[model samples]
Target chain A: MSVEPLDPSTLPEHDNLPGNAHAYCVRLTGPLFVQTGRMIAHYPAGGGTIRFEPLTATSLGTLVAERFSSPLYSRDWVVANGQGHVLLGDRGYDINSYDLDEGNLTVRAANLLAFDAGLELKESIVPGFLTLIGTGRFLASSSGPVIFVEPPVRVDPEALVGWADCPAPALHFDAGWMGHFLGAARGALFGTRSGEERQYDFTGAGTVLLQSSERLREDPHALRRLEGEVRQLGPGALQQLQAVVQQQLAEHQQQQR
Target chain B: MSWRLRTPRVLVVDLDGSRGSAVRARTGSMVACEGEVSFKDAGIGGGGGLRAALKQRVAGESLPLMEVSGRGSVHLAVEAGHVLLLELAGEVLRVESESLLCLSEGLRTDVAFTGLRGASSGQGLFTTSVTGHGRVALLSLGGPPIALRVTPRTPLVVDPDAYVGCLGEVRQSFVTDVSWRAVVGESSGEAFSLRFEGSGTVFVQPEERR
Candidate 1:
C-alpha cells in the first residue's frame, strides 16, 4: 500500500542498468546486495517505495549488491562470500542468487504481490507474492501463481496465454498423423491434437505472467493477413485500422501498469 | 405397431401410445405429423416434398396417403403431437415446423440422436440433413430467426455434423491426403479438413464432434 521513498544520492552503485527508465535503489551498506525491477523494497526493519535513476555500467555491481542486501541487512543477517538471503515481507521470501560473473544476482521473491520491469511493485490482493529477475518479459496476470523458472528459454505467447507458471508440456504427434488430418505431408509444422499441450498449466490461486518469444510465431499467417488487409485499405479504412491498433496498444499499456 | 420403409426412402408407422416415433423419406417426399416425431436416416438424397394427410386413420377404413414429394418420405404416428419437419438443401440446412416442403435435389440427408447433459435431460432424436445450394429455413423454439451473412473474402469453417447451411459458393479441400496409416498416426481423425476457398458462407454449431 504505502512505501518509504529512498534518496538517490545515498543509493548504491550499479552498472549497465537501463538508463532513461526509472529505477528504485535500496541501500543495504553491506558486501551482499540485490537490485530488482520493482519499486516497493522491503526489509525486516521496514519497507518502503523508492525511485532511482538509471546507473552507469560501472556502478552496476555495487547497486546490485546494495539492493540484494537491503532486506537481509536490516534483519541483522550476515553477508558471507558476498551473498545474503532474506524472507521477503510477511507474505514471501527472497532467494537472492548473486552471480559475480554476471555482475547481477537474481532476486526470486515468492508469495507477495505484483511486480513489473518498470521498478514498480504493488501488493497483490490474491494470496501471492512477486518475483523479479533479470531476464524474460514482465508478466502480469490474475490467473494463477507458479513461476516456472527455465531461463534462456523462449515460448509462444498465444500458446502461453493460459500457462503462467509451469514447464511447457511435451507435444506429441507424428508427421504421418499430420498429413492424414490436414491432408499435408508433414505434421511437425502444425501441432497435432488440439489440447495436448497442457504441460504449461500453472496451478495456484494467482496468475502466471510470462514473456515468450514463441508468441511472435503464433498465427504468422493471421498477422500477415491482417497487415495486408490494413495496407490494402484506402484512406478511410486506414483510419479505422489505425484506431483499432491504437486501442490495442492502449490496452497493453494499461495491463503493464 | 410401426412399419419402417428403408427402401423407397419412406417409413409408415402407427403410434399406439408410445412417447417416441421415427420416420424416413423416400424419393424426396415430406411428411407432416400431429405429434413430435424423431427423424433418423441412413442417408437420403436431397429435394422432395411432404404434406399432411387430410384423412385421419380410423379402425377399419382405407389407409390415408399423405402427399409426399422428393425421393423418399417417412411418416410416424404419434399421440397428441406437434409437427416438426426437417429438410436438407445443398449448402443450407433448414428446419421448418409450419412451412410447406419444396426442397431441392442437390443436398444430402441423414438422421441422428442427440443428448444434453445436466439436470432435466433425455435423449432427443432429430433429423439432420445437409444441403448443397439454396436457402433452408429452421423454425426456432423461440425468438426471431437470426441471419448471419458470410461472403467470399470472409469464409467460415464449421463442423460438418453441426453444419446447418452453406452458400455453396466455396470449394472444399482436404488439409491432407487420405491414407489408412495416416489416420492411425497422430493426425488421424483430424487429418481431413474441409477446406472452403472462394466466396460463400458455411453455417456451423458451437459444438462439433471429431
Candidate 2:
C-alpha cells in the first residue's frame, strides 16, 4: 500500500520525509542556497512562485557576495528564492539538517546539500571541504546515518563525512605502509594497496561525522579543484603532468581493451 | 493463489493454474519460483492489443511482459529496485514504463502523451497509463518512493528525473526558467521542472534518474 500523501501544510518545515530518510523538505520563507541538481520537487504557496537563480544572477549579487566567499564553488550552487516547500534528495543518501548557533562547521563539499542565507560559507583550508560560519541551518547527506565521534579519533578518508568545531585533520599514513613503501624497490611503482593505508587524524576538541559506509560517490567538485590547481604549475611541471596523464590514459585504454 | 511481498524489493505471486490467477510481469524480472510454473511471452503490446503496441512503439514506452501461469509461486524483482504495490479501484495510474514491475490479469495498459516535459527528464514524451481494477507493482530506483499531495491551492513543481508517477486527477505542465543565461549555456540544473496542478497524488523517488 502507498503511504499517506504529504501536502505543504502537513510537511515538516525542515526535516526528512516521513518513513524516508533520503528525502528532505525545506519550508522556504527566505532565500536559501542550494547545491546544483539536489532539488527534487517543491510545492508553491498560493499566489507565490519559487525561482532557482544561479549565483551570477544580478538580482542576487549583493546577497551572494556577502554570504558566499568560495569562488571555486560559484558554479555549483544556486539561490532558491520564494515562498514554497522545496524537496531535496541527493543520490538516495540520508539527509539531515544541522543547526548552528553562532558556531561553525566544515563539511565535505559533496555531502553539503543546502544552507541558509545567514550562514557565511568559505572554502576550508582542506581541498574538498567547505566551512559554514554563523548562526543558521544547513543540510547535508551521507550514505547512511552520520555517526558522531569525538576527537583523538582516526577515520578512514572515505568514511569521514565532516567535522565540527575541530581543527583541520592531519593526513595519517599507516606506519607499516610508510615503512614498506620506503623499503620497497623501484618496480614497486605498481604498489599493492589495501585502500586503507590513509586516514584522517582528528586530534582536537569537537566532533567528527562519519558515514557507516566507506563507499564514495564521484565528486565533480574534486575534479574541478584539481583542474584549478593544475594552472599553478610551471611549464616544466605542466609537461611532466601531461606525460603522467598520457601514461594513465594509455594504461586505462589497455585495461579496457 | 495470492500476491505477497517477500520484501520491500521482492514480490511473490502465487498461481494456481487458473486463468484468473495468472499474472503479467516484466520480462527477466523472475528471480525465483517454487513448484511447477510456465512462462509465455505476453506479446508485443504487453497484452493490451495491437493499438496499444503501436502507440507504445511510437511513444517509446514499451513494456516487455511475460505471462506466468501454473501451480506455483513465483518471485519477481528488477534491478534491485524497491517495489510498491498499488491496488486500483477503477482509478487511473499513470507511470513510467521502466518502473512497472507486474500487473494482475484485469488491468489495461495504454499510452498517453506527456508533452515536452519528458524531453528534459529523458523519460520520453509519453507515459504508460494503467486503468481498470487490479493490483500493480511499481519499481523505484535509488530508494523508497515519496508520495506528495497536490491541490488547487498548492501546486507541485518537480524535477522530471525524480518523478515516478501520479494517481487520481492531476494535470502536468512544463515549467522552464528561460533567461538570457540559459541561452548562454550557464543555466542552473533546475532550468526545467515539471509543475502539477489540480487535485491528486504524485510519487517521486529519493534519487533522480540519471
Candidate 3:
C-alpha cells in the first residue's frame, strides 16, 4: 500500500502514526524540552521559524535553570522554542507518552525522549535515571513495548525501565543460599543460568515499567557518576582501584574469547 | 509501484518475462525466485560505464549492483531492513550508496562528490545520484524513513547520521554550532549536522548510523 507523505498539516497532534511505535509527531504550541538530536523534523503551522537553543545558553536561561535541575543532562538537552510541529524518533525504539497529574515518574536517562516544560526535571537518586515531577506529559522510549506491573514484586535489573509514584527499589537476592550450596554439593554447581539470583525488589505501592527486550544503551550518566565517585579517593587508593579495574578488564577480555 | 511486499523486510518484484526492461539490484541481494530468472553482475560501477566506475572507485562510494532479468516473482531483502518504495519524476535523488536497494531500467545511477559531510556523517564523502523517471526502493536500518518537505523559507537542519537521502533541487551544507557542542564532551556523537535549503524532499531514518 502506498502511504501518503505527511507534512505539517496532515500530521497527527500529540500522537504517533497508527501502529507506528518508532516515530512521534507533536503539535508544539509552546516550548518543549527535547533530548539532543531527537527532533528529526519540524513543520511550522504558522510559518514561524523554530529554533533549538541549548538548555544551558538559551535566552530562557533563567527558566531553564529552574525547570531543569540536573547538570549532567544540561548539555544533552535543548529547548525547542517557537511555533511548529516537531516530529521525534529515537533509534527505532517504541515511544510512549504518559500524562502525570501532579505525580512523580522516574525513567532511565537515555530512554527519556521529551517532556513538557511544565514538568520539572531532576536527577533521580538512582544513577542513570531522571525523575519528572508536576502535572504534564513526558515521552520515553523502550526497546520493546513497555509492560506495566504493580509493585510488591521483584523485577530483573535489565528489564526494569522505571517506576512511577513509588519508593526506590532495593537489590533483592533469591534468599536461598543454603539451597544453592546444596545444589553445588550435588554437582549441579554454580552458574547454571537460572537467572534467579538477583533482582530489583519493588515494594510499597506504585507501578513499575518493564521492557521485554533486555538490550541497553551505554549509560553516560552512570559513568559520570563513577567518575564523580572516584574524586573522593586518595592517590594511593586511586592507583589500587586502577589495578583492580585493569584486572577486571583483562578478565573481561579473556571471557570474550 | 506495482511491486508487492512479501514482508515488511522483503520486497517482491514480478518481472515481465518478455520485456527488455530490467531491474538492477544490490549485489547478492537476490534471496528467492519463483520463475525463470537470470542474475548477472551489472559490472563496474553498477552499469554506469567506465567513467562512472572510475568516479565511484575514486570517490569511495561503491554501489555494487547485479542485473535481474526474466519473468518471475523475486524476493529481495538487505540485512532485514525495512524497504521504502519511492516514485521519482525527474528529480535528482542523492542517496548514500549503502541504502540504495534497487533501481528501474530508465534510472541513471552515478557517483557524485557530496563534500566533507560524508566523512563526518559516516555515509561517505560521495553519494549515489539517481535521476530520471522510475521507482527507487531504499533500505533503512529502523522503521520507515521520514520524508520531510523543505522550502526556501523553511530551511531544515538534520543530524548527518540519520540522513538517508534527498530528492529535488536542494543545496546541503554542513552546520555545526561548536560553542555549545564543545561542552557536550566527546560522546555527543553528532557535533556536526547537515543543513538543507531549497524546495524538495529529504528522507531521514529514525536511527543514527553507528
Q: Pick the candidate with the highest DockQ.
A: 2
Residue lDDT tens for model 2, B1-210: 598888888999999889888999999999999989999999978888899999988777888999999899999998778888888999999998888999999899888887774333346368889999999988877778888998899899888788888898999887777531352244236557788888999988888776
Model 2 pairs in collision: none
Tens-place lDDT per residue, model 3, A1-257, is: 23455666567899975557888888877778989867766665455656677876688888898899998878788887887677788878888999999999999888899999889999988777899999899999888899999989899888878999889898876758546766575556555446757788999889999988755667767777888899999999999999989998998999999
Error of 3 at B35 (Å): 4.1
The chain B TM-scores of all candidates, as shown, are 0.32, 0.91, 0.90
User: Candidate 1 lDDT, tens digit per residue, B108-136?
Assistant: 33332222223422111122334454322
- Write down the worst ten-residue block by lDDT for model 1 chain A: A83-92
- Residue B37 lDDT in candidate 2: 93
Query: iRMS of each prediction in angstroms?
Result: 27.8, 2.3, 2.8
Report fnat for all candidates as fractions from 0 to 1: 0.00, 0.63, 0.27
Separately for all candidates shown, the number of backbone clashes (residues 3 or more apart, or on different chains) is 80, 0, 0
Ranking by DockQ: 2, 3, 1
Provide the lDDT at A173 for model 1: 46
lDDT of 3 by residue, B75-137 (tens): 889877788888888989999888888888889999987667433434535789999999888
